[model samples]
Target: MFDIRLRIPSWHRLHSFLGLGASLFFAFMFLTGTLLVFAPELDWLRYSEVRASPQGSAKLSLGTIYDAAARARPDWDIVTLVRSEGAWFADQVTGVRPEGRDAFLWVNPYTGQVNGETSSFTIHAALLRLHEALFIPGRLGKLVVTVFAIPLTATVIAGLFLYRRFWTGFFRWPRFSSRSRAWLSDLHRLIAVWSLVFFVPLVVTSLWYMVETVGLNAPATPANRTVARDQLLPPDFNGARLDAASAIAAATLPGLEVRKVILPRRPAQPIVFQGDHTAVLVRPRANAVYFHPESLEVLGAHRGEDLSLHQRIAEAADPIHFGTWGGLPTRILWGLFGVGLTALAVIGIIIHAKRVGIMQQKIAGASARSGFARVWRGMGPWGLGGWLSVGLVVTGLALLTRNFLGA
Candidate 1:
């Protein structure tokens, strides 16, 4: 009889190696992601100027707001005006300054006053960059981050396989009176079992990101008509037609709540009115209307309902992954689970370290004489080498990205 067990790799060792190898990176991502869940609110809390009194309705027109932003920053080329979702939130007007850097001005819709300004590198932007690419620059960084989905998915499967009866552990509590290792293991399993709901969707969305990053499952975009150079608006255009264009957009798409107004920057660009309609899970940009830059004439419109199946799924990915589909409650739930995932990584590391310490205590020969040799023995040659390699690669990539961005 063939010994099938002999050919199979040790699932326990594989699980530990996979989990440990990416645990630090996973913790970092989880922390940053959790912060991003309430990024807007964080900024609102930090910057008092972004806060506004709850007005029943907007007192000023979109054109007035645009003019106010332009007057506030005369040197900048106003690019977008994002409408506030809440009455107490200030509308955002973003513009490109010299050297192509963006500046955001918070304008009170009720008064058309520019409350304050911030650079493009706000806390949210910095955290998003770190979460998406670890600040490693272009497509390469994105690919590197997305590729981790493979190991992460594998680790989850291996974990579930190791604890085949994970469902039974849902109601089980960790024994506080037990040894530290035993309690830690119990807590780890308990958290993992409870977090299965979040983990499944997280893994699915992460894999989708990997697919998209590699250009495998590209989503279809609406075909845009190019504007001629001769049709471009003059530099001194005051955006007086913005109010009329917005009204036209609202009439074009019934029930459309315009969230963002993207202004044209170049001759071949159109003013874009991006918003949400009755679409359930799609993004604001999913439903949009385009207009001629100078004429304010309707060019085309895209309904969220008109999206293909693949495109709908792609559109839903971010909302699902970030738990934004359900508003505040889901975001809170996602943040809690994110903390749980972070704890799992930390607990897994502690558990492994304790186990390794026990193994080292039993080895009392010359091989464990020096601190380096002891660490080598404790982690094993492969484990130490893998950690070292990851550290070096991450450091090098960070430096390279910094230099690239600087240049």
Candidate 2:
């Protein structure tokens, strides 16, 4: 009989290979994700135009704000209006500016004044693109990013198995007085044990992303009606009827607090009021009311409570993955854990280098050829492929940045 153990690769080696292979990508993901957790606050700090002072308990009508935004950029086609959650936040109005570039205008809900405009290519938006697709265009980029989840999941599982009784490491601190490798090992285990909580959800959600991207377990397409060309809002439309439409939506969904108003720019698209109901983890888009473009009549409505089980899970993924369910406090906790995970990836490489004698070789003034050999040997089996993948992604990102900056 053949021994199964002989066929299976060593978990220790597999774990190292997987971790080392994807270390750079893992660092990129964690860093960008952590920043995205507080992207709104970061944008607020970076752009003064997004800041506003609350005038009173009530805000100006949505139509008035819409008119103000349209008046501010008469040449542009208004697309969407995102209501601000905080008293000091300015409502955002997105429009298609000349040359087809998207522009974001801040509208003060109280004063109905267009505060200022900013390009859609904000720092946070660029970070989001990098995080989601590494600047690779189309579904290919998304698939490439999602595929890494498999190795990440395997690494986490292998880590748990390798470090048996990982629970014991929870209270243990790194031994600073010990040798470099010893302390590094201790620190790696300590961080890995503590970050399991974050890793579990991250891997799970990442796998879900992969599944959805591959067309498996995809969320149901929202039901919306198409209208005729004549029914579309004209170029000179003043949005005078948006307030009545909003009132109709509020009455249609009694508890819905509208968060976004998706204006129709094309001929067939309908106006959409995306909002939140009483559902705890579902996104605002999950609970929405669609309206006819010309008549402003209610076309359809979706409530979070009415979603299918798969749909509900899909809707909850974003909030859970980003730690947005509990708002700022949870986001802060997630960011801290993310930083710890990022450090683990960096430290894992250092520990591997030290273990393989690369550090000592370099310290002893080893020849360039020997150093290169040692570095190559440290990669194990999966390292080369991982680096090649990273190289391709980096090339794509560099080209994308060049074109974007040049444009």
Q: What C-alpha lDDT values do all the predictions have?
A: 0.80, 0.82
lDDT of 2 by residue, 82-185 (tens): 98777888899999987887889999888987889987776667767777877778888878888999999999998987898999999999999999989999
Index of the highest-TM-score prediction: 2
In candidate 2, position 169 carries an lDDT of 97
Candidate 1 residues 64-108, lDDT tens each?
A: 999999888888888899887767788889988878877789999
TM-score computed on alpha carbons, candidate 1: 0.89
Off by over 4 Å in 1: 1-6, 56-60, 217-220, 230-240, 362-381, 384-407
Indicate which candidate wins on lDDT: 2
Scored against the true structure, residue 275 in model 2 reaches a CA lDDT of 86
